[model samples]
Target: MLIEAAGLCAGYGDARVLHGVDLSVGEGEIVALLGRNGMGKTTTVKALMGLLPAMAGRIHMGGTDVTALPAHRRARLGLGLVPEGRRVFPTLTVEENLRATAVPGGRWSLPDVYALFPRLAERRSNFGNQLSGGEQQMLAIGRALLTDPRVLILDEATEGLAPVIRREIWATLARLKDEGQAILLADSRLQAILALADRAVILTKGEIAWTGATAALQADAELQRRHLAV
Candidate 1:
């Protein structure tokens, strides 16, 4: 596995959110983390990214135990995140955002990112605050790719975007999958996830309710209703 998290338990101050959660992402695999609101999806991302300290359990990246490492250290170890809300630096230009965390000898370069997201190229000189929501999301993904990460985790990759923009993002993800990138995606769009992800992990009330191939998840309507239905 490229990323392995076992028995992960974490939360905000005095309010635990995750309870012994376990997940793994292999190379060239796309895994979807699904759940309704406040079910610990973002919390899991935070724990995995070291943004929130894990109160229990372990995290291993590229087979190295890194549960105690800081966020920057984990990023250096090849864990990249395109966080929820597309948190790009408002003061930085699109080009600068991509350049800020770029590492030498990486497979993804500015040109490659530009090619993947031509809109970014068109607005390369624009500040992050000046871009539309979809453009900012693209910039976030581009910035993460520039790190040459072993695994990419995207929280709500297509949330709050126009249908056309959402389709574009999904297509981009498909291309990345074809090129053997490992992705961990969290989104509310069940259909899109079923089409894109190899496996699915359903979180319900801070615990993994189910984990299986996408086909199995698709076939189980009752499971979806119990945990995912709004």
Candidate 2:
């Protein structure tokens, strides 16, 4: 597995949002983490990225234990995250935002990112706050790509975008998958996930409710209703 977490437990203050979650993303694979709101999907992503400390669990990257590492260390070890809200630096130019956390001598570069999202290239000089929501999302994904992550984790991959932009993002993800990028995606869009992910892991109140191939998840309507219905 490129990224693996076993018995991951975390929370805010004393609130314990996640409980014994186990998930993994292998090389050249796409895994979708699905659940309704407040079900610890984001917490799981944060824990794996080292943004949130694991209360009791183990996280491994390329078979090396990384549970004790900090966020920067995890990034160095090849964990890249596109957070829920597309949190780009408001004060930085688009080019600067891409460079802020970038690791030199990686597979990604400024020109490559710009080519992937030409809109960003067009707005290269604009501050993060100056861009629209979809532009910010593209910038976020581009910034993460610049890290050359072994496992790219995206939380709420496309939450609040126009239909066209959402489709564009999904298409970009498909292209990434084609190029053998290992991705762990947490999103509410079921149909898109089913089409893109190889495997599916469903969560309910922090614990894993069900896990299997995406085909199985798509076929089980009752299971979806039980754990994923809004």
Candidate 3:
């Protein structure tokens, strides 16, 4: 497994979120974390990235226990996250934003990112805040990829975007998956994720409701209704 979480727990001050959540993303696999809103999807990613503290359980990136490691330390272990929102550096230009968090001596480089998203290359001088919604998203994904992460995560990757942009983003994701980059994706678009993902894991409330191949997940409508519907 490229990334694994065993019996994980995390929460706000007193409102506990995840309850023994067990999830894993294998190398070169696109694993989608499916759930309705506020179902601890983003929280799980945050905990794994060390943005939030894990009160209990183990977080292993490539079989090393990184539960106690800080976010920067985890990044050094090849973990990259394109957060819930497209949290780009508003003051920095597109190129600068990619320059800031980019892990040097990594597999992917500046030219690679430019080649991946030509639109970003055109807007290289635009500050993050100046980019369009889709452009910002592209920058976010590009920034993460520049880290050359073994496991790259996206939380609500295409939320609140135009249909065209969303489609483009999904297509880009498909390309990334084809390139054998391990991806952990959380989004409201179940159908899209299911089609692209090799495996699907549904989170109900805070527990694992189902875990199976994408085909099985799609065939079982009852599973979706129970764990995913509003």
Quantify all predictions' global Cα lDDT against the true fold.
Answer: 0.93, 0.92, 0.89
What does candidate 3's lDDT look like per residue over 126-170, in tens digits?
Answer: 999999999999999999998889999999999888999999999
Separately for all candidates shown, the number of backbone clashes (residues 3 or more apart, or on different chains) is 0, 0, 0
Candidate 1, clashing residue pairs?
none
Flag the better candidate by lDDT, 1 or 3: 1
Tell me the spans in candidate 3 whose CA falls farther than 4 Å from its real position: none
Model 2 CA deviation exceeding 4 Å by range: none
Mind giving the per-residue lDDT tens digits that candidate 2 earns over 116-224? 9999999999999999999999999999999999888999988988889999999999999999999999976587898899999998899999999999989988887
**What would the C-alpha RMSD of candidate 1 be, to one decimal place?**
1.0
Superposed by TM-score, candidate 3 places the C-alpha of residue 158 at a distance from the truth, in angstroms, of: 0.4
lDDT of 1 by residue, 1-230 (tens): 99999999999998889999999999899999999988989999999999999999999987699999999999988989999999999999999999998999999999999999999999999999999999999999999999999999999998899999999999999999999999999876687888899999989888999999999988988887877743
- Give candidate 1 misplaced runs (Cα > 4 Å): none
| Residue pair clashes in candidate 2 | none
Q: What order do you get sorting by TM-score, best first?
A: 1, 2, 3
